[model samples]
Target: MGDLAAVVAARGVPAQEVMDEYARTLDRLVDPVRHPSLCWLRESGRLGTPDEPDHDFRFGLERVLDGVEALARGASA
Candidate 1:
C-alpha cells in the first residue's frame, strides 16, 4: 500500500491521485498476471528497476504516517 503511495507521491502526485493510483494498482495485481505486485513500478526517468520491495516501502510509510500524526498533535497543542 505504502509502496504504491510512495510511487504516486514521488511522482509529485496529490494524495487523492495517489489513492486512486493505488486502487488501480491493486486491481491490476488482483487479476491474473505473471507477477502480482503490492507496489506499482515507475521508470523514475531511469532504465533501471528498484531493488527494494513493497515491505520496505510500507515500513517507511508507517513511520511517515506516524511522524505526520506527531506533527499534527504538536501543531494542535
Candidate 2:
C-alpha cells in the first residue's frame, strides 16, 4: 500500500470533489463480476475517508508482522 501512503501524504484527505470523481470512476470501471472484492469494498461505504492516514498502514503492517512471526516459527520448527 505504498502508493496509498503516497497519495495520502500528498493530498492530506481528499476534498469532496475529488471523492466524487473517485466514486464516479469506480462506478464506471469496477465491474462486480470481474472485481468482486473491489466492488464489495466500494459498496461498503468505507472508501475515501483517509482522515487517519496511518490506520490502513498500521493494519497492513501488523498483518505483515504476523506473517513474519509465523514464518519464523516454522523455520525454528
- Can you tell me which runs of candidate 2 are displaced by over 4 Å? 1-14
lDDT tens string, model 2, 1-77? 45555665578864554566677799999889999999888788777544365776798899999999999999999
Q: Flag clash pairs in model 2.
A: none
Q: What's the TM-score of each model vs. the native?
A: 0.32, 0.65
**lDDT digits (tens) for residues 1-77 of candidate 1:** 45645676679766556555545565555543543342333222221323334756677799999999999999999
Off by over 4 Å in 1: 1-52
- The best candidate by lDDT is 2
